[model samples]
Target: MDHKRDKEAVLHLYNKILPPLAEKIYQNLTEVTPLFDDFHLEKVVDTWTKDRNTTSEKEISLENGNVQQMGLRLRLNGFQAAGAQTFDLSKDLVFLLEYSTYTVGPDKNTRWLEKPYLESWTSKEMEETASRWCEEIIDEITQKLQTL
Candidate 1:
Protein backbone atom coordinates (compact mmCIF):
# COMPACT_ATOMS: atom_id res chain seq x y z
CA MET A 1 0.00 0.00 0.00
CA ASP A 2 1.23 3.44 -0.85
CA HIS A 3 2.07 5.38 2.31
CA LYS A 4 1.00 8.60 0.68
CA ARG A 5 -2.35 7.16 -0.26
CA ASP A 6 -2.86 5.87 3.25
CA LYS A 7 -1.95 9.22 4.73
CA GLU A 8 -4.33 10.95 2.39
CA ALA A 9 -7.08 8.58 3.36
CA VAL A 10 -6.45 9.27 7.02
CA LEU A 11 -6.45 12.98 6.44
CA HIS A 12 -9.65 12.66 4.52
CA LEU A 13 -11.24 10.88 7.47
CA TYR A 14 -10.09 13.59 9.83
CA ASN A 15 -11.36 16.39 7.66
CA LYS A 16 -14.55 14.74 6.59
CA ILE A 17 -15.83 12.80 9.58
CA LEU A 18 -14.22 13.62 12.91
CA PRO A 19 -14.88 17.35 13.09
CA PRO A 20 -18.61 17.10 12.63
CA LEU A 21 -18.86 14.27 15.10
CA ALA A 22 -16.81 16.19 17.62
CA GLU A 23 -19.05 19.20 17.17
CA LYS A 24 -22.14 17.10 17.67
CA ILE A 25 -20.74 15.58 20.83
CA TYR A 26 -19.76 18.99 22.11
CA GLN A 27 -23.21 20.29 21.43
CA ASN A 28 -24.77 17.45 23.32
CA LEU A 29 -22.48 18.00 26.29
CA THR A 30 -23.32 21.67 26.35
CA GLU A 31 -26.99 20.92 26.37
CA VAL A 32 -26.65 18.68 29.40
CA THR A 33 -24.23 20.82 31.41
CA PRO A 34 -24.24 24.56 31.64
CA LEU A 35 -20.63 24.49 32.78
CA PHE A 36 -19.75 23.61 29.24
CA ASP A 37 -20.66 27.20 28.41
CA ASP A 38 -17.43 28.39 29.99
CA PHE A 39 -15.35 26.22 27.70
CA HIS A 40 -15.01 25.49 24.03
CA LEU A 41 -14.47 22.15 22.44
CA GLU A 42 -11.49 22.16 20.12
CA LYS A 43 -10.97 19.50 17.49
CA VAL A 44 -7.37 19.14 16.41
CA VAL A 45 -6.03 17.01 13.58
CA ASP A 46 -2.37 16.11 13.61
CA THR A 47 -1.55 14.39 10.35
CA TRP A 48 2.20 14.34 10.83
CA THR A 49 3.26 10.91 9.59
CA LYS A 50 5.21 10.04 12.71
CA ASP A 51 2.49 11.32 15.05
CA ARG A 52 -0.77 10.86 13.27
CA ASN A 53 -3.61 11.59 15.68
CA THR A 54 -6.87 13.48 16.12
CA THR A 55 -8.06 14.99 19.38
CA SER A 56 -10.90 16.96 20.90
CA GLU A 57 -10.17 19.05 23.98
CA LYS A 58 -12.05 21.36 26.33
CA GLU A 59 -10.72 23.26 29.33
CA ILE A 60 -12.49 25.66 31.66
CA SER A 61 -11.39 27.72 34.64
CA LEU A 62 -13.87 29.08 37.11
CA GLU A 63 -13.08 31.53 39.90
CA ASN A 64 -15.21 30.43 42.85
CA GLY A 65 -16.57 26.98 42.29
CA ASN A 66 -15.89 23.52 43.65
CA VAL A 67 -14.70 22.60 40.22
CA GLN A 68 -12.24 25.34 39.51
CA GLN A 69 -10.89 23.74 36.41
CA MET A 70 -12.17 21.00 34.15
CA GLY A 71 -10.48 19.40 31.23
CA LEU A 72 -11.75 16.88 28.74
CA ARG A 73 -9.75 15.09 26.07
CA LEU A 74 -10.87 12.69 23.40
CA ARG A 75 -8.48 10.93 21.07
CA LEU A 76 -9.43 9.44 17.76
CA ASN A 77 -7.41 6.55 16.39
CA GLY A 78 -7.26 3.16 14.65
CA PHE A 79 -7.88 4.35 11.12
CA GLN A 80 -7.49 1.82 8.32
CA ALA A 81 -8.16 1.80 4.63
CA ALA A 82 -11.23 -0.13 3.65
CA GLY A 83 -11.13 -2.91 1.07
CA ALA A 84 -12.36 -2.32 -2.46
CA GLN A 85 -16.15 -1.89 -2.76
CA THR A 86 -16.49 -1.58 1.02
CA PHE A 87 -18.27 1.20 2.84
CA ASP A 88 -15.92 3.81 4.29
CA LEU A 89 -17.00 3.96 7.88
CA SER A 90 -14.88 4.67 10.92
CA LYS A 91 -15.14 1.01 11.82
CA ASP A 92 -11.50 0.82 12.78
CA LEU A 93 -11.69 4.16 14.53
CA VAL A 94 -11.47 4.33 18.31
CA PHE A 95 -12.34 7.19 20.63
CA LEU A 96 -10.66 7.55 23.99
CA LEU A 97 -12.29 9.96 26.43
CA GLU A 98 -10.57 11.38 29.50
CA TYR A 99 -12.01 13.76 32.07
CA SER A 100 -10.12 15.88 34.61
CA THR A 101 -10.99 18.35 37.36
CA TYR A 102 -9.17 20.71 39.70
CA THR A 103 -10.03 22.66 42.83
CA VAL A 104 -9.15 26.22 43.67
CA GLY A 105 -6.53 26.64 46.32
CA PRO A 106 -6.28 29.31 49.01
CA ASP A 107 -3.44 31.01 47.18
CA LYS A 108 -5.50 31.05 43.99
CA ASN A 109 -3.61 28.10 42.59
CA THR A 110 -5.56 25.21 41.12
CA ARG A 111 -5.02 21.85 42.78
CA TRP A 112 -5.61 18.58 40.99
CA LEU A 113 -8.46 17.10 42.98
CA GLU A 114 -9.22 14.47 40.38
CA LYS A 115 -7.06 14.28 37.35
CA PRO A 116 -9.24 11.78 35.50
CA TYR A 117 -12.68 10.67 36.55
CA LEU A 118 -13.45 8.72 33.44
CA GLU A 119 -11.35 7.00 30.82
CA SER A 120 -13.05 4.88 28.22
CA TRP A 121 -12.87 3.83 24.61
CA THR A 122 -15.57 3.26 22.02
CA SER A 123 -15.29 1.27 18.80
CA LYS A 124 -18.00 0.78 16.23
CA GLU A 125 -18.26 -0.14 12.55
CA MET A 126 -20.27 1.67 9.88
CA GLU A 127 -21.43 5.29 9.97
CA GLU A 128 -24.57 4.72 11.99
CA THR A 129 -22.83 2.45 14.43
CA ALA A 130 -20.02 4.86 14.96
CA SER A 131 -22.44 7.74 15.45
CA ARG A 132 -24.46 5.83 18.01
CA TRP A 133 -21.31 4.86 19.83
CA CYS A 134 -20.24 8.49 20.01
CA GLU A 135 -23.64 9.57 21.26
CA GLU A 136 -23.61 6.98 24.00
CA ILE A 137 -20.13 7.98 25.07
CA ILE A 138 -21.12 11.62 25.17
CA ASP A 139 -24.18 10.79 27.23
CA GLU A 140 -22.05 8.92 29.71
CA ILE A 141 -19.61 11.78 29.93
CA THR A 142 -22.39 14.25 30.49
CA GLN A 143 -23.82 12.14 33.27
CA LYS A 144 -20.41 11.87 34.85
CA LEU A 145 -19.87 15.60 34.63
CA GLN A 146 -23.18 16.44 36.24
CA THR A 147 -21.98 14.79 39.42
CA LEU A 148 -18.91 16.99 39.50
Candidate 2:
Protein backbone atom coordinates (compact mmCIF):
# COMPACT_ATOMS: atom_id res chain seq x y z
CA MET A 1 0.00 0.00 0.00
CA ASP A 2 1.24 3.50 -0.73
CA HIS A 3 2.05 5.35 2.47
CA LYS A 4 1.32 8.74 0.96
CA ARG A 5 -2.13 7.68 -0.17
CA ASP A 6 -2.74 6.07 3.19
CA LYS A 7 -1.72 9.27 4.93
CA GLU A 8 -4.07 11.23 2.72
CA ALA A 9 -6.96 9.00 3.73
CA VAL A 10 -6.26 9.60 7.39
CA LEU A 11 -6.13 13.33 6.90
CA HIS A 12 -9.33 13.22 4.88
CA LEU A 13 -11.28 11.68 7.72
CA TYR A 14 -9.91 14.15 10.24
CA ASN A 15 -10.87 17.04 8.04
CA LYS A 16 -14.34 15.64 7.31
CA ILE A 17 -15.51 14.71 10.81
CA LEU A 18 -13.77 16.99 13.28
CA PRO A 19 -15.20 20.28 12.17
CA PRO A 20 -18.85 19.28 12.49
CA LEU A 21 -18.26 17.48 15.76
CA ALA A 22 -16.47 20.51 17.18
CA GLU A 23 -19.13 22.87 15.96
CA LYS A 24 -21.91 20.93 17.63
CA ILE A 25 -19.88 20.74 20.83
CA TYR A 26 -19.30 24.47 20.77
CA GLN A 27 -22.97 25.15 20.28
CA ASN A 28 -23.78 22.78 23.11
CA LEU A 29 -21.38 24.70 25.29
CA THR A 30 -22.98 28.07 24.61
CA GLU A 31 -26.52 26.85 25.26
CA VAL A 32 -25.72 26.22 28.96
CA THR A 33 -28.93 24.40 29.75
CA PRO A 34 -29.26 22.25 32.85
CA LEU A 35 -27.24 19.76 30.91
CA PHE A 36 -24.57 22.35 30.27
CA ASP A 37 -22.17 23.75 32.84
CA ASP A 38 -19.15 25.96 32.68
CA PHE A 39 -15.94 24.01 32.83
CA HIS A 40 -12.54 24.23 31.30
CA LEU A 41 -12.13 21.56 28.71
CA GLU A 42 -9.88 20.94 25.76
CA LYS A 43 -10.39 18.47 22.97
CA VAL A 44 -7.83 17.19 20.54
CA VAL A 45 -7.52 14.45 17.95
CA ASP A 46 -4.54 12.40 19.03
CA THR A 47 -3.68 10.78 15.70
CA TRP A 48 -4.82 8.51 12.92
CA THR A 49 -3.55 5.22 11.62
CA LYS A 50 -3.56 3.62 8.18
CA ASP A 51 -6.28 1.18 7.25
CA ARG A 52 -5.23 -1.72 5.10
CA ASN A 53 -8.65 -3.29 4.84
CA THR A 54 -10.70 -2.70 1.77
CA THR A 55 -14.42 -3.44 1.74
CA SER A 56 -14.65 -3.88 -1.97
CA GLU A 57 -14.53 -7.45 -3.23
CA LYS A 58 -12.85 -6.11 -6.33
CA GLU A 59 -9.99 -4.84 -4.24
CA ILE A 60 -9.98 -8.07 -2.37
CA SER A 61 -9.60 -10.10 -5.57
CA LEU A 62 -6.39 -8.18 -6.20
CA GLU A 63 -4.98 -9.08 -2.81
CA ASN A 64 -6.16 -11.05 0.22
CA GLY A 65 -9.95 -11.19 0.31
CA ASN A 66 -10.42 -11.49 4.03
CA VAL A 67 -8.64 -8.33 5.10
CA GLN A 68 -10.52 -5.25 6.26
CA GLN A 69 -8.42 -2.11 6.19
CA MET A 70 -8.90 0.60 8.71
CA GLY A 71 -7.89 3.57 6.61
CA LEU A 72 -7.75 6.02 9.52
CA ARG A 73 -8.66 5.92 13.15
CA LEU A 74 -9.31 9.23 14.87
CA ARG A 75 -8.77 9.26 18.59
CA LEU A 76 -10.37 12.21 20.29
CA ASN A 77 -8.94 12.98 23.72
CA GLY A 78 -9.91 15.69 26.14
CA PHE A 79 -9.22 17.00 29.60
CA GLN A 80 -11.21 19.18 31.95
CA ALA A 81 -9.83 22.65 32.48
CA ALA A 82 -8.30 23.77 35.76
CA GLY A 83 -10.30 25.89 38.23
CA ALA A 84 -13.31 23.88 37.20
CA GLN A 85 -13.11 21.27 39.92
CA THR A 86 -16.59 22.12 41.17
CA PHE A 87 -18.00 20.41 38.14
CA ASP A 88 -16.72 17.16 39.51
CA LEU A 89 -19.89 16.31 41.37
CA SER A 90 -19.63 12.73 40.27
CA LYS A 91 -16.67 10.79 41.53
CA ASP A 92 -16.16 9.35 38.08
CA LEU A 93 -15.99 12.87 36.73
CA VAL A 94 -13.90 11.75 33.86
CA PHE A 95 -11.96 14.70 32.56
CA LEU A 96 -10.53 12.72 29.72
CA LEU A 97 -12.09 10.58 27.05
CA GLU A 98 -10.67 9.01 23.92
CA TYR A 99 -13.05 8.22 21.10
CA SER A 100 -11.32 6.27 18.40
CA THR A 101 -12.96 5.29 15.12
CA TYR A 102 -11.90 4.37 11.63
CA THR A 103 -13.06 5.04 8.10
CA VAL A 104 -13.07 2.53 5.23
CA GLY A 105 -14.13 2.99 1.65
CA PRO A 106 -13.09 2.00 -1.83
CA ASP A 107 -10.91 4.50 -3.60
CA LYS A 108 -11.11 5.06 -7.32
CA ASN A 109 -8.48 2.47 -8.08
CA THR A 110 -10.36 -0.18 -6.16
CA ARG A 111 -13.75 0.61 -7.60
CA TRP A 112 -13.31 -1.42 -10.73
CA LEU A 113 -12.25 -4.48 -8.82
CA GLU A 114 -15.45 -4.82 -6.83
CA LYS A 115 -17.24 -8.13 -7.26
CA PRO A 116 -20.33 -7.43 -9.30
CA TYR A 117 -22.29 -9.97 -7.30
CA LEU A 118 -22.11 -8.05 -4.00
CA GLU A 119 -20.86 -4.55 -4.69
CA SER A 120 -23.98 -2.50 -4.02
CA TRP A 121 -25.13 -4.61 -1.12
CA THR A 122 -21.78 -4.51 0.61
CA SER A 123 -21.31 -0.83 -0.02
CA LYS A 124 -24.75 0.08 1.26
CA GLU A 125 -24.44 -2.05 4.36
CA MET A 126 -21.05 -0.67 5.25
CA GLU A 127 -22.18 2.88 4.61
CA GLU A 128 -25.26 2.48 6.76
CA THR A 129 -23.25 0.96 9.57
CA ALA A 130 -20.71 3.74 9.44
CA SER A 131 -23.39 6.41 9.44
CA ARG A 132 -25.17 5.00 12.47
CA TRP A 133 -21.97 4.50 14.42
CA CYS A 134 -20.63 7.94 13.64
CA GLU A 135 -23.91 9.54 14.61
CA GLU A 136 -23.99 7.72 17.93
CA ILE A 137 -20.39 8.59 18.66
CA ILE A 138 -20.83 12.25 17.79
CA ASP A 139 -23.94 12.48 19.91
CA GLU A 140 -22.27 10.86 22.90
CA ILE A 141 -19.15 12.97 22.55
CA THR A 142 -21.11 16.17 22.13
CA GLN A 143 -23.03 15.46 25.32
CA LYS A 144 -19.84 14.73 27.19
CA LEU A 145 -18.03 17.74 25.77
CA GLN A 146 -20.85 19.99 26.88
CA THR A 147 -20.95 18.51 30.35
CA LEU A 148 -17.26 18.95 30.81
Candidate 3:
Protein backbone atom coordinates (compact mmCIF):
# COMPACT_ATOMS: atom_id res chain seq x y z
CA MET A 1 0.00 0.00 0.00
CA ASP A 2 1.02 3.59 -0.64
CA HIS A 3 1.58 5.42 2.63
CA LYS A 4 2.08 8.68 0.79
CA ARG A 5 -1.42 8.38 -0.60
CA ASP A 6 -2.64 7.66 2.89
CA LYS A 7 -1.09 10.89 4.13
CA GLU A 8 -2.57 12.97 1.33
CA ALA A 9 -5.98 11.45 1.87
CA VAL A 10 -5.79 12.46 5.51
CA LEU A 11 -5.02 16.04 4.63
CA HIS A 12 -7.84 16.20 2.13
CA LEU A 13 -10.28 14.76 4.62
CA TYR A 14 -9.67 17.48 7.19
CA ASN A 15 -9.39 20.38 4.78
CA LYS A 16 -12.55 19.61 2.89
CA ILE A 17 -14.80 18.28 5.61
CA LEU A 18 -14.41 20.30 8.80
CA PRO A 19 -15.53 23.69 7.57
CA PRO A 20 -18.71 22.44 5.94
CA LEU A 21 -19.54 20.21 8.85
CA ALA A 22 -19.32 23.18 11.15
CA GLU A 23 -21.51 25.21 8.88
CA LYS A 24 -24.09 22.44 8.86
CA ILE A 25 -24.04 22.28 12.63
CA TYR A 26 -24.91 25.93 12.92
CA GLN A 27 -27.59 25.69 10.28
CA ASN A 28 -29.20 22.74 11.95
CA LEU A 29 -29.02 24.38 15.33
CA THR A 30 -30.58 27.59 14.07
CA GLU A 31 -33.34 25.67 12.38
CA VAL A 32 -34.11 23.71 15.51
CA THR A 33 -33.60 26.47 18.11
CA PRO A 34 -32.58 29.90 16.97
CA LEU A 35 -33.45 31.61 20.22
CA PHE A 36 -30.51 29.95 21.83
CA ASP A 37 -28.10 31.49 19.35
CA ASP A 38 -26.66 33.21 22.36
CA PHE A 39 -25.57 29.87 23.64
CA HIS A 40 -24.91 27.58 20.68
CA LEU A 41 -21.68 27.67 18.71
CA GLU A 42 -19.48 28.95 21.46
CA LYS A 43 -16.03 27.45 20.83
CA VAL A 44 -14.01 24.54 19.60
CA VAL A 45 -12.25 22.83 22.45
CA ASP A 46 -9.13 21.29 20.98
CA THR A 47 -8.20 17.90 22.35
CA TRP A 48 -6.04 14.97 21.32
CA THR A 49 -6.66 11.32 22.15
CA LYS A 50 -4.26 8.42 22.10
CA ASP A 51 -4.96 4.75 21.60
CA ARG A 52 -2.47 2.53 23.37
CA ASN A 53 -2.26 -0.05 20.66
CA THR A 54 0.08 -0.83 17.84
CA THR A 55 -0.91 -1.16 14.19
CA SER A 56 -0.41 -4.88 14.14
CA GLU A 57 -0.13 -7.20 17.09
CA LYS A 58 2.01 -9.59 15.11
CA GLU A 59 4.56 -6.88 14.43
CA ILE A 60 5.44 -6.24 18.04
CA SER A 61 8.61 -4.36 17.25
CA LEU A 62 9.88 -1.41 19.24
CA GLU A 63 9.77 0.67 16.10
CA ASN A 64 6.09 0.07 15.56
CA GLY A 65 3.91 3.13 15.82
CA ASN A 66 1.15 3.74 18.35
CA VAL A 67 -2.26 5.12 17.51
CA GLN A 68 -2.67 8.87 17.92
CA GLN A 69 -5.58 10.99 16.80
CA MET A 70 -6.61 14.63 16.59
CA GLY A 71 -10.28 15.19 17.29
CA LEU A 72 -12.63 18.01 16.30
CA ARG A 73 -13.82 19.98 19.32
CA LEU A 74 -17.07 21.89 19.24
CA ARG A 75 -19.16 22.53 22.33
CA LEU A 76 -22.44 24.28 22.87
CA ASN A 77 -23.68 25.44 26.24
CA GLY A 78 -26.44 27.38 27.97
CA PHE A 79 -28.95 26.39 25.35
CA GLN A 80 -32.63 26.17 26.14
CA ALA A 81 -35.87 25.77 24.27
CA ALA A 82 -38.14 28.71 23.67
CA GLY A 83 -40.53 27.66 26.45
CA ALA A 84 -38.02 26.28 28.86
CA GLN A 85 -38.31 27.95 32.24
CA THR A 86 -35.34 26.34 33.99
CA PHE A 87 -33.48 24.15 31.60
CA ASP A 88 -30.26 24.34 29.63
CA LEU A 89 -28.50 22.11 27.13
CA SER A 90 -24.84 21.47 26.68
CA LYS A 91 -23.51 19.27 23.92
CA ASP A 92 -20.12 18.15 22.64
CA LEU A 93 -19.73 17.96 18.87
CA VAL A 94 -16.47 16.18 18.56
CA PHE A 95 -15.24 14.67 15.29
CA LEU A 96 -12.56 12.06 15.46
CA LEU A 97 -11.11 11.85 11.96
CA GLU A 98 -8.53 9.10 11.84
CA TYR A 99 -6.15 7.24 14.08
CA SER A 100 -2.57 7.79 12.89
CA THR A 101 0.53 5.82 13.66
CA TYR A 102 3.97 7.33 13.98
CA THR A 103 6.74 5.05 12.96
CA VAL A 104 10.20 5.53 14.40
CA GLY A 105 13.28 6.26 12.29
CA PRO A 106 13.41 7.45 8.69
CA ASP A 107 10.44 6.64 6.50
CA LYS A 108 8.81 7.92 3.34
CA ASN A 109 8.63 11.63 2.61
CA THR A 110 5.36 13.48 3.06
CA ARG A 111 4.48 17.11 2.55
CA TRP A 112 2.89 19.25 5.23
CA LEU A 113 2.86 23.05 5.24
CA GLU A 114 5.21 22.88 2.29
CA LYS A 115 7.64 20.89 4.40
CA PRO A 116 8.66 17.27 4.72
CA TYR A 117 7.13 14.82 7.14
CA LEU A 118 8.21 11.29 7.77
CA GLU A 119 7.21 9.94 11.17
CA SER A 120 4.76 12.25 12.89
CA TRP A 121 2.54 15.19 12.09
CA THR A 122 3.91 18.73 11.97
CA SER A 123 2.56 20.88 14.77
CA LYS A 124 2.98 24.19 13.04
CA GLU A 125 1.42 22.88 9.86
CA MET A 126 -1.54 21.45 11.67
CA GLU A 127 -2.01 24.68 13.60
CA GLU A 128 -2.00 26.73 10.45
CA THR A 129 -4.58 24.44 8.89
CA ALA A 130 -6.77 24.67 11.96
CA SER A 131 -6.61 28.46 11.88
CA ARG A 132 -7.63 28.47 8.25
CA TRP A 133 -10.43 26.04 8.93
CA CYS A 134 -11.72 28.19 11.78
CA GLU A 135 -11.88 31.20 9.50
CA GLU A 136 -13.61 29.25 6.79
CA ILE A 137 -16.17 27.78 9.13
CA ILE A 138 -16.85 31.16 10.66
CA ASP A 139 -17.29 32.70 7.26
CA GLU A 140 -19.79 30.03 6.32
CA ILE A 141 -21.63 30.44 9.57
CA THR A 142 -21.87 34.17 9.10
CA GLN A 143 -23.23 33.78 5.62
CA LYS A 144 -25.85 31.38 6.82
CA LEU A 145 -26.82 33.72 9.64
CA GLN A 146 -27.19 36.66 7.31
CA THR A 147 -29.65 34.70 5.25
CA LEU A 148 -31.66 33.88 8.38
1-148 per-residue lDDT for model 3 (tens digits): 3243133544443454445545555554454444444444432322233334433443321122221222244443343444443233343333332343221111123212321223334454444544554454455444545554
In terms of lDDT, model 1 sits at 0.32
Please state every model's RMSD to the true fold in angstroms: 19.5, 13.2, 12.2
lDDT of 1 by residue, 9-67 (tens): 33333354456555655554454334222334444322221212323232221111112
Which model is ahead, 1 or 2, in terms of TM-score? Answer: 1
Cα lDDT computed for each candidate against the true fold: 0.32, 0.33, 0.38
| RMSD over all Cα atoms, model 1 | 19.5
Candidate 1 vs candidate 3: the lDDT winner is 3
Model 1: weakest 10-residue lDDT segment is: 60-69
Q: What does candidate 3 score on TM? A: 0.38
**TM-score (C-alpha) between model 2 and the true structure:** 0.28
In candidate 2, what residue range of length 10 has the lowest lDDT sum?
Answer: 89-98
Winner on TM-score (2 vs 3): 3
Badly placed stretches (over 4 Å) of model 2 are 1-5, 33-43, 47-85, 88-148
Top model number, TM-score: 3
Deviation in angstroms for 33 in model 3? Answer: 4.0
lDDT, residue 79, model 2: 31
